[model samples]
Target chain A: MDSMMMGAMTQSMKSMPDMAAMDMSVLQACMDACAACEQACTVCSTQMMDCSPACMNCADMAGTMMRSMLRMQGMTAASMMAMLDACIAMCQTCMDECMQHADHSDACRMCAQACKDCMDACMAVKDMMMASA
Target chain B: MDSMMMGAMTQSMKSMPDMAAMDMSVLQACMDACAACEQACTVCSTQMMDCSPACMNCADMAGTMMRSMLRMQGMTAASMMAMLDACIAMCQTCMDECMQHADHSDACRMCAQACKDCMDACMAVKDMMMASA
Candidate 1:
């Protein structure tokens, strides 16, 4: 996310006292990871491999996770937590499926790594939320 | 999706014996609803209303749900059910938020209607799954 967008987000979120305290840089990292993972999974899904379905699912979930972070005004801590958990589960599933085909396909290998990175980034946000709570 | 894409989807899922019993038309309707809801939510989110966050979340979940159906080869009945439940919940939340501004915003009204229609379509698929299971 750009500084200008972050400033706009901060302005828009001023009403939410809870979100006002959010670390913009951390959130930005997570969102970027989600976007990257979504793209990787999207490319991997077109491969027509057995992992395609998982890749598609991961792509969708990652995109949602990224967008949700962008729209923090609509979320409660509970809803955010649930969404993060779902994203993590979807990434794990996708990573596992992609790993099976990693040796045969470079796309799957890169996608699996992306999924792992996204899951880690999401976990960091979850940890931050928990600590703040 | 058009008839050509539907035909292609059918060809791709030939390996899935369980999906062979699936009704393509019903699935098509559900996917269409999801796609429409996603588009509506995406537009609504950019409106920067209180509903924007929910709209963004709905857009992501709806898109994911639609793509997952397209890649049915990757899902089990259980995973499909979970995803449908998540999508329905997200749509209901978005619709509720958008309805709050329906009197003032045409976009919100349209997005709310799309969410409702998507929820109905998803429920129909769930009912079909239950019957088949």
Candidate 2:
């Protein structure tokens, strides 16, 4: 997210008490991770491997997680946590599935890496929220 | 998704144990609902209301849900259920938030309606899975 968009979002989200104190950098990192993971998974799914379904599911979940972060005004700490947990689970599942073909498929390898990155990013957000709380 | 794409998907997913038995019509309806909800939420987010965040989140979730349905080869019954539950929760939250301003905003009203429809469509898929299981 750009500063201009972030400015607009922050301004619009003044009604949310928790959002006011949220770290934009942490949120932005997670969004970026989600976007990357979604792209990787999309490409991996095209390979028609056994992991294709998991890749597709991860891609969607990651995209949703990114968008949710972008629209933080709609989130409570609890909702955010739940969403993060779900994202992490989906990523982990995808990564596990993709890793099975990592040696045979470059796309699966890359997708697995992306899922790991996304999981780490989501965990970071969860950690930040916990610390803040 | 078109019949051609659906055909391709079904062909590619032949390796999945359960996907062979899945009903395309039920999955297609859910995908359509998800796509509609995503669009409605995207438009609603542009309104910059308090619900914008939730709308954005819902939009992403709905899109992801739709795509997951399209790529059913990667899904297991358990993962599908988890994804559906998360999607339902996100839609319910978005609907609740959007309904608050429905009287003043057509976008919000449409978004809320879309969320409700998506929720119902997802529930139908769940019910179908349960009946089959």
Off by over 4 Å in 2: A1-15, A18-29, A42-53, A104-107, A127-133, B1-15
lDDT of 2: 0.84
**Clash pairs of candidate 2?**
A53-B74, A54-B74
RMSD of each: 3.5, 3.5
The digit string of per-residue lDDT tens for model 2 on A4-114 reads 877776675676777666676887788889999999999998996578778878987898788777777777776677678778888988998999999989999999999
**Candidate whose lDDT is highest:** 1
CAPRI tier for the interface of model 1: acceptable
Interface RMSD of the predictions, in order shown? 2.1, 1.8
True contacts kept of each: 0.42, 0.54
Chain A vs native chain A, TM-score per candidate: 0.95, 0.93
**Poorest 10 consecutive residues by lDDT, candidate 1 chain A:** A74-83
Number of the predicted model whose TM-score against the real structure is largest: 2
Please give, for residues A12-124, the per-residue lDDT of candidate 1 as tens digits.
67787666667778888899999999999999999966888888888888888888888888776666776787788788888988999899899999999999999999999
